[model samples]
Target: MSRLDDIIELIQTTNEVYFITAPGRVRTAYILVDDIIELSLKVFLQEKVYEQRVNCQIDLESASLVTSRNHKDSLRRYFEEKLNIDELSNELGRGTTGVPILQNHLVSFPLIRHWSANDPNARHTFDRVIDDVKPFFALPTTAPVGTPPNPATNLLDEALIRHKTRNKFYHDQNLSGLDINDEKCLSALCAMFDLVDHLFPTFSDEVKSKHTVRCQIGVLRLKQTASLGHRELSQPYEAALQLLKKGHKYDFERRSVEHSLVHTVSDRFFGSLREQFKNTIAKLQVRINKIDTMARPKQDHIDEKNDKEKLIQILQKQLDQINALLGAP
Candidate 1:
């Protein structure tokens, strides 16, 4: 299974354990949920770092960091060698080789900071990431007026609180006095859903159906939309419209959804319509040519000319419609 699927399975197992009638399981559930969130974030951060490295033309294999085992080293080499950001690289470089970084480094807040500093694509991806979490941290004005205030201001706040609670449980080794409870465990599970949704929106359906715990968190509904195919199509359509408005040349190398939609629409719908129009226009032109070649009565020639002129007008109107759909001014 993929790493994402593994994390999702862990999340599902945690939810099952949280709801089962068992003593001393609430703390375990919380830790499990927190671990899933951290793991999901680590996977997401590694992907972003790798993508940026590839964009910068850094050779992952040549740097001896092609495999997932050496992704942290790859990230360090990329930032230090490619971008020349020695400070960030050195900061990320402190951990021993092959050892996982701390929770803070893998989570959204710190990873987003590093990405935003170095990559332009980070802002767009971060905006989407923030959107996934907004429902969790929504305010009355920002959300519906009757809704409850968002519990945390941002993802960092949520991560910090959960991490602190987890550390207390692990380091202190005393759950009796700790504040971990069913409600807190549920909140952490919800946060895990948000993080996973941000990283892999397409997996939302699988996560929702497989998770056993039922919660009243508002973010669940938002995650459901990610599974919608029509919603996915709208993204490409809107992008295509924006590109059309800007009058920019299409980048064939990118092969974006917009690019595919343009070609699909042209070939399947507009291309066929254009061919039909061309046939009609060609037929009219042939009749006009024949009328000119043959010695017909002046009145007969005038009537044929008028008929050809009417067909030309009709053809022009159809052509205009086609051009309008093609985004011609």
Candidate 2:
């Protein structure tokens, strides 16, 4: 099997991996760190047993994947800010109340949906909704210096934005559409994933041990919840351009060194114009041999002299051109 396939198989043995997919062929994979999974599992099993022992007040729909209730407020706001009610309502065949209520219940659930609110004013407050969902957004506030944010995180966040923006674009009749498959965008995401994998080896190690399934299924789930778009991938492209510029500068410097050697031979080593002129004469003699070999009978001394003179003139012109090309400091 391929490396990724092997990883997928290994992750299947553990419950920490999942894949997600969405519109525009968007795909994402995620793996819960082993420690985090262990912690969450302990809480999950305890809670699961408690529900079985008691007449639970909470409906199955209200169950959330996040073990902690502290993230609830942030999650609520994220859905509000992200959903375009009018368009989402149209797509989901549900009224405005359906969206917020479902979002509330999804605290433990990871369902992707076209959410909306009953109040027209609340529905119109797109920015407010975004503010609410900021907690759910995946932009990292801290990373090691010189390191970009996690690739999976970046992709997940962009997917969220595009997911939210898609309804707005459609409602506003905007022509712009999401482009998830953009080459640069994909490259940036791939790089980010690679970086994340490098720093946190657990993801790959788990897969190698067959303790993780296709954790990519989680990203696929997220994608179905979100959307993708075609705009620029931003920082990655700029970084690449900067690298190219540095390479160009190095090449120019190397060529300048070669030009200096040519100048050393013609101007410095030859010293006086008389000696340089004699060297040119010697070069002319070598070229004359080739010309005479091509002739029916070797040309007379006059012909040879004329060829030598012409060669000297040509060399003088080339030297001038080279000097011009390598302008004075």
Per model, state how many residue pairs clash. Answer: 0, 41
lDDT values, one for every candidate = 0.50, 0.36
Candidate 1 residue lDDT tens string, 113-171:
34433553443432344444344335645466667544444554576567766878657
**If scored against the real structure, what TM-score would every candidate get?**
0.37, 0.20
Model 2: lDDT to the true structure: 0.36
Model 1, position 153, has a per-residue lDDT of 43
TM-score, prediction 2? 0.20
Q: How far is candidate 2 from the true structure (C-alpha RMSD, Å)?
A: 25.4
lDDT for each residue of candidate 2 in 156-175, tens digit (9 for 90 to 100): 35434544544453466555
The runs of at least 3 residues in candidate 2 whose Cα sits more than 4 Å from the true structure, single-residue gaps closed, are: 1-159, 165-172, 176-202, 209-329
Runs off by more than 4 Å, candidate 1: 21-25, 58-153, 173-176, 205-329
